[model samples]
Target: MKILKFISVLAILVILVFSFWIYRSLNAPYSHNKNNQYIQIPQGSSPGQILVKLTSEGIISSPIPLKIYLKITGTGKEMQAGEYLFNSPITPLEVLSELKSGKLRTVKLTIPEGFTRFDIAKRITGQFPQNQAAGEDAVLKLTEDISLIKDIAPQAKNLEGYMYPNTYNFPRAVTTQAIIKQMVEEFKKVWKPEYADRASELKLKPHQIITIASLVETESRLDEERPVIASVIYNRLKKGMPLGIDQTAVYIAKMENRWDGVINKSDLESNSPYNTRKIIGLPPGPISSVSESSIKAALYPATTNYIYYVLNVDKEDKSHRFYSTAAEFERGKAAYQTWLKKERK
Candidate 1:
C-alpha cells in the first residue's frame, strides 16, 4: 500500500509539471528583440488549424498550451478571423483574448473640402475593386442608370453631389450599394428641411443652392471665407452680373480636354454654360462636391453692401476689405501682386 501511494504521488507531480510547461510556453511573449509583425487569421479557421498556423509562423512557442487554454477557458468556439497588428511583445493569451473579441483592423479615408461627384466616384471606384463592393463602372452606372440608384436615393438624378464628403471606414465585405446609400443618407441627414423653405423664399431651387455651394467650396480653402465668397456670388446674381469664377473656366477647359496647368485668356472667354466668366447667374449644376459649411454659406450669405473683393496684396489669405467700387478692389489687387512676388521668391 505504501509503494502504491508513492507511485500515485509521482504520477500527479509529472502531470502538473507538464501542464505548467505547456501553459508557460504557449503564453510566452515574443522576445524583446522581436520584429513588428501582423498575424492573419483566415476566415472560418478552426482553433486547431489556427494553432498549427501560429506554431509554424513562430508566433506561439507551441500549440499544446494554446489548445489547452482554449479548452480550459471555454473559448475554443469564439475565435474570429481578421488581420491583427502587434508592435510590442504579445503573448498567445493576449492574442486569443483579442481574436475572441472580434477586434478587426480599420483604415481611414479623407475626402477633401472640394470634390465633384465624378471625382468622388472615381475615388470610391479605386478602393472598391479590391473589396467585395461593386466595381467603379457598376457604381457610376447606378448613378446615371436610374434603375440602380432608385432604391438608394429617389431624389438624386445621378449620384452627382449626393456622395457626402467625410472620412469613412469601409469593411472588407461591404457592398457597393451599401456604400452609396451610407453617403447619400449622411447628406440627407445634414440638409435641414427649413433650408428648403428658405430656398422657396428666395425663389431658388435646391439644385441651385448646391451649385452655389460647390462654387463656394472651390473658391476658398479657408473655412471662414466661404460664406463671404458666397455672399459675393449672391450679390453679383442679384444685380445680373456675371459670377466670373475661375474654377468654372477650369471645369470647361477640363471637359473640352484643352486644359493645361495654367488658365489662359481663351478659357476665360469659353462659351460654355459653366463658364461663369461669360455667363450670368449660377452655373447649370454643381461642378464639385460640397461641404456642410459651404452649403450653409450658400443658404445664408454674409450681410454686406460690398460686391467686389480682391486677394489682399500683403496677405492673400487675410480677409478682403469689402469694396463697392473697382478702384478699391484694384488697390487690394496691387497689394496682392506685391505679396505674390514675395511668395514666388
Candidate 2:
C-alpha cells in the first residue's frame, strides 16, 4: 500500500510538471533577435519545415515546445504559406495564429483620376518592374487588350477611360496584367445598370458617354462646374460646332508621341479626329480615365442655353464662366487671356 501511494504521488507530480511546461510554451512571451524582417515560406511548405525555418532565423527560440503544442491542438495542418514579418517578444501561439491566417506583406499603388493609359502604364512599370526586362512599353501593350471590356464597351479602342483610378494594395509578386484587370474590374463595379439606362434616355451609347465623361473630367475640377461644363459640350455638339477643348489637342499630341507640355500651333492644325479644335464632334474614344462624378455629369447635364465657357480667372478654383452668345464668349476669352498673361509674368 505504501509503494502504491508513492507511485500515485509521483504520477500526480509528473502530470503537474508537464501541464506547467505546456502552458508556458504557449503563453510565455519570447523576444527574439529577428524583428521586422520578412520571412517567406514557400508554397506547399510543411508545418515542420515552417517551424524549422522560423527557429533557424531566430524568429523563435525553439521548435520543440511549439511542435508539442501544435500536436496537442491538432493545428499543424492549418498552417499557411506566405511572406510574414514577425515582431519580437511574440508568443508561439500568436505566431501560429498569424500563420494560420496567411497574412502577407503588400505594396500600395495609386492611380489618380483623369490619368491617361500612358500615364498609368508608366506608373505601373515604376511600381512593379518586370522580372523579364519587359519595359514600360510592354506594360502599355497590356492595356491594349480590349477583350476585358468587350461586353461593356465594344467600340472602345483600348482601356483609356475605363481603368478606374484609385489606390490598390497588392502582393509583391503580383503581375502587371493582374493590376490592369483589377483596375478595369473596379471601373465595371462603379458603372451601374442605371447608368446604362440613363445613357439610353439621353440617346447616347456607353462608349459616347464614357468619352464625354472623360472630356468633362479633364475640363473641370469643381463638382459643381462639371455638369455645367458638360452642358457646354452638349450645346456645342447640338450646334454642329467644334468643341475646341485644348485638352483634346493635348491628347492628340500624346497619341502622336509628341506631347511637349506646350500646345503648339501645329497641334491645333492637326486633322486628327481627337483634336476637338478641328473636329466637330466627340473624339473617337475616351482620352483619359473617367471618374464617377464626371460620368454622372455627362448623364445629367444641367439644362442651359450656354454654348461656350472660359476660365473664370477671378475664382481660384479653376472654375469657368458660361456664355450663350459669341460676343459674351469673346469677352470672357479676353479676360482669360489677360489673366494668363499676368500669370506668365
Candidate 3:
C-alpha cells in the first residue's frame, strides 16, 4: 500500500510540473527582438511546417511547447497559410490567432493625383520586388493595353489619365498587369454615365476631356482654381492661341525621357505636340493621372474670358492669377519672373 501511494504521488507531481510549463510557454512572449517581424506562411503549409517556420524565423523560442499546446486544444489543424507581419514580444496565442485569421500581408501603395504612368510604373516597380524583377519598361508596357479603357476612351492610346488616383493594397506577389487593370477598373467606377453627356456638350471626346483634366491637374493644385484653369484652357483652344502651360513642356520632357523636373528653354521650344507652349490646341494624349475633381472641372468649365494664368507670388499657397488680355498676362508674367529670380538668388 505504501509503495502504491508513493508512486501515485510521484505521478501527480510530474503532471503538475508539466501543466505549469505548458501554461508558461503559451502565455510567455517569444521573440528574438522587439522590432517588427515578418514571416511568410506559404500556401498549403501544414501545421507542423508552420511551427517549424515560426521557430526558424525566431518568432518562437521553441515549437515543441506550442505544438503540444495546439494539439491539446484541438487547434493544431487551424493554421492558415499566408505572409504574416508581427511585432516582437508577441505571445504564442497571439501568433496562433494571427495565423488563423489568414490576413496575408499587403503592400500599401498610394498613387497621388497627377502622377503620370511613368511615375506610377516607377512606384510599382520599386514597391514590389516581384515587379522590379520584371523592370519598369515592362510595367509601362503593361499600361499600354488599350482594351482596358476602350469603351470609355475609344481614342485613347493607352491607360494614362484613366488610372484614377487612390490608395491601393496589393499583395506581395501581385503582377504589373493586375495592378494596372485594377487601377483602370477603379477609374471606370468613378466615371458616371452623365460625364459622357457633359463631354459631348463641350464638343470633346472622353479621351479629350481626360486630356484636358490631366492638364488642369498638373496646372493647379487648388480645387476651386481647377474650373478657372479649365476655362483658360478652353478659351485658349477656342481662340486658336497656344495654351502656353509650362507643365505641357514638362510633359514633353517626360515623353522624350529627358525630364529632370526643370523646364529648360529647349523644352519650351520643343516641337512635340505635347508641348502646349508651341502647340495650337490640345495635346494628342493625356499628360498625367487625373482626379475626379479635375475631370469635373474639365467637364464643367467656368464662364471666363481669361486665357492666361501665372502663379500668385504674393500668396504662400500655390495659387494663380488669371488674365484675359496679353498686357495683363505680361504684367503677371513679369511679376512671376521677378519672383523666380529672387527665389533662385
- Overall lDDT per candidate, in order of appearance: 0.74, 0.90, 0.89
- Model 2, 298-323: lDDT tens digits are 99999999999988898888888999
User: Which ten contiguous residues of candidate 3 have the minimum total lDDT?
Assistant: 30-39
Judging by TM-score against the true structure, name the best candidate: 2
True lDDT of residue 96, candidate 3 = 93
Candidate 3 runs further than 4 Å off: 1-35, 56-78
Of candidate 2, the 10-residue stretch with the lowest lDDT total is 128-137
TM-score of each candidate structure, all chains considered together: 0.79, 0.96, 0.84
Clashing pairs in 2: none
Q: Give, for candidate 1, the lowest lDDT window spanning 10 residues.
A: 145-154
TM-score of 3: 0.84
Residue 62's lDDT in candidate 1: 73
For candidate 3, write residues 100-195 as lDDT tens digits: 888777899999999999899899999999877778888889889999898998888888898889999988788788889999999999899999
- Candidate 1 local Cα displacement, residue 192, angstroms: 4.2
Give the clash count for model 1. 5
